[model samples]
Target: MAERVVPEGQRRRRRPTKQGAVLSERLIIDTALRLVTQHGADALSVRRLGTALGADPSSLYRYFRNTDDLLLRLADEFIGLAQEGFTPSGDWRADLRDMGLRIHGVYVENPQVALLAAHRTTGRAHETAAVEKILGILRGAGFPDPTAVRLYHAFVDQALAFAALDAAAQALPTPAREADEEVWLSSYGRLPPDTHPNVAATFPLLAADMRDSGYPFALDLMLEAAEARLRG
Candidate 1:
């Protein structure tokens, strides 16, 4: 007897599990996200997800090819959440600022997801839409094709990079996170001016500023540079 082979571009029929739950792609993605959020990204395996959804582990293949494939879908979903309800105000700087903040905020809210998927290229619908929107905004603001592409690349990379960095901090255990935050005050702020002049001088400002995510400040600098390029 020969084993069965499913064709490409088609899925096997989905059936209810022993627990009487009918699983779909959306359900699977949602469950996976919840699992990642609750148990960390390492818990996003098929067996765990199956247990969470009360479906057999093999049933997930009907929707996703593998864990990697599911991860891409999850990444795209994060992009979707960030872009949801976003409408451009036609001011290029303001639009970009809003979008950048949106991405940062969403990633911070879902720290585990951001830590795992922020660096991935999903190449899916939500990601495609975000790319198109950014390019359109840049081109509409009088940036030439090459310049637009360059700025687009820089803008996205900056957003994701900072998001991942901040998310990593956010994902840290409470005690570790608190200890890290205390470093500026406990160590850097108390530096001797004679030996560490710059540190001593900047300690006041650093103490006030280091408590927050630096994404917004970095984002503003990037936008300012882009504005300058547009002016030239």
Candidate 2:
């Protein structure tokens, strides 16, 4: 039998074999996740991701059929983050609040990615797990199965819808924030005294910090309602 021979220089190199060099679907998804989070969804493209990963753009096709496919994975990443953060301690109301706040925090952290994942539902692992957790909490609290499912839908949908809008608002560039403030200032500064009495009198509050207060306030209101339902 002939003995196999090793090539020179290759014997000592730590470079991965062709099989090892092949990236996993997870790796590609992870790269796309970070890219979308930092750069808006529009900023993500197979070519750019390929360039960043030092692989040919076509290599991405091996993992994702197209950019939309990659986006769905990115959306799953957000759900994964929410699942990782979720912890329900058998208290339905508290669990729902915790989930809502956690989801909000996840979106706020990756505002750009939040915009992409906000409304779309892939029913992937992270999302499915999160739903199961919520259902478990509701069921443990004495709700019927159908009620638990309905509550789960409302809770997750409201949280995500609000998160998407909030993130899109917050994700605006610095110049955009400044411009928005300037527009409010200009518009409020010119309000008439009689016809828009309330507007004129409350211009300061009307134009006050629109980002932080409203988001948490809205979340609190939803949680409050959920708690009330559970109590009833």
Candidate 3:
């Protein structure tokens, strides 16, 4: 009698491992995320993930084709988290702002995941749904297809880019992160008044603002530009 050969990424039946833990795609992704969060992105590997799951490393291929596939799924999972419970208020500016903030907040919360997945295009379910929702919002607000797509591209890319940048800072070692936070005060704030007139004059404001993520301001600027285009 011949044994069965399971094809990659097409295994339909969930099975329990030797340790009695049932393996599922969501469970695998969640475990992967936990590993990345606790041990950094370098912790994401076949051996580590299998050990963490207490399953055979080959079992993961049932859900994802490879490490890269798992990564895309993880990226889409972050998108799912961002879009979870989100409802469009029908006001284009407000909706865009809300969505932008949500993306930034979620990514920042999962800094390791953001650091790994922010720049990758995950054409998975959640990513597709988000794209659809944003485009629908823009089109519903009177923008034509081309304009809507352009706006959606800019909006999403800007959000992801800023989120990744902030996440990188957050992912730094504690001392390094603290040092970065103090730069506005220790370096920029203490610049010679005559040598750096503008910075010296605005150091107080910079000190206050530099402590926060700049995503909100950047989001608003993009929304404002979109609003202007819509108006004209």
| Predicted model with the maximum lDDT | 1
lDDT to native, each model: 0.89, 0.73, 0.88
lDDT for predicted candidate 3 compared with the true structure: 0.88
* Candidate 1 residue-wise lDDT, 83-196, digit = tens: 999999999999999999998889999999999999999999999999999999999999999999999999999999999999999999999999999998999977899999
Model 1: what TM-score? 0.93
The C-alpha local distance difference test score for the whole of candidate 2 amounts to 0.73
Worst 10 residues of 1 by lDDT: 1-10
Q: Write the per-residue lDDT of candidate 2 for residues 78-109, one digit (tens) a residue.
A: 77777684555766676778778888778878
Task: For candidate 1, give the lDDT.
Answer: 0.89
Q: Give lDDT tens digits, candidate 3, residues 148-186.
A: 999999999999999999999999999999998888888
**Top-down lDDT ranking:** 1, 3, 2
The C-alpha TM-scores of every prediction are 0.93, 0.79, 0.92
